[model samples]
Target: MKKILIIGIVASGKTTFAKRLSQKFSLPWYELDSIVHHNTATGRYKRSAEEQFEIIKEIDIKGAWIFEGTDRDSYQCLYQMADTIIFLDTPLWKRKVRILTRFIKQKLGIEKCHYKPDIMMLKMMYKWTRDFEQSRNSFDAKLNRYNEKVIRLRDSNNLDVTKGTRLS
Candidate 1:
């Protein structure tokens, strides 16, 4: 429960769950995407795999943290480092709706995003979600190694932050 890794596809509620869990435990949270794509004084740039690993290691030294993002080969080590892993298995229909809603919000300037909220990005989100489903068997196999520490959630709201437990 100390070091948590929340992994999910786009619009799977990883960020929301991480925020709630972090607040409940008074622990710092991080977006893995931010680590991969470093934002600097000049602009955002994708960091080298080695640089990303260094940043992750620096954060790991802090003892406890919540890192959330879609799975990436660059940070596969997170699975070994995390004390717990949360896989937000939100329904495909819900996630699809969320993707559209999120895009609308971002385009309307009601929501913030690190990347551009354009048609291409929206298309990519859907593509990623489909790809995730196609590759879920492999992902599940990878997670099987850490089954004891992994919690699968179909709905983020079903988690009881106060008790750090799942309600259903």
Candidate 2:
């Protein structure tokens, strides 16, 4: 696909999958988290919504790109420009395990995350994973409004980045 949008709850493998897709297709990939969070001498701070919109607009005008994250309201224009959208509908239990594992790794300095890992971040991740089902409905509705091919990968095994064809 020329342009791809990967959306999912935090720690649901969006970044991982997008990276794979980017490598497979030889297209650049952008992690929305990295764009939104700016590291300063003080601490990590988010860019203004207008700034985020401008950044996304620049990416959308590129020849091809794969963007991973969920900020539908802010990146609606990018969503419209995407040729394909892949939704990582991973189960809650798996998401919980991933979130916890990632937190431990980041805390131990074994893994680097876009944002620092802390107790507050961990708690927020847990709550997001627990309430993901409710958020999923809104994602579905948004996807329904777009005509681009949307692939819902419910399990990790279902995604085959090597296969260029869109999943039915």
Q: Which candidate wins on lDDT?
A: 1
Model 1, 1-168: lDDT tens per residue?
889999999999999889988888899999999999988899899999999999999999989999999999999999999988888888999999999999999999999999999999999999999999999999988888888788788888756633333323
Superposition TM-score, candidate 1 onto the true structure? 0.94
Candidate 2 TM-score over all chains jointly:
0.87
Full-model lDDT for every candidate: 0.90, 0.78
Model 1 lDDT, residue 55, Cα: 96
lDDT of 2 by residue, 30-103 (tens): 98877787778898898877888888888777789999996546667777778888878777888888988999
| Lowest lDDT 10-residue stretch of candidate 1 | 159-168
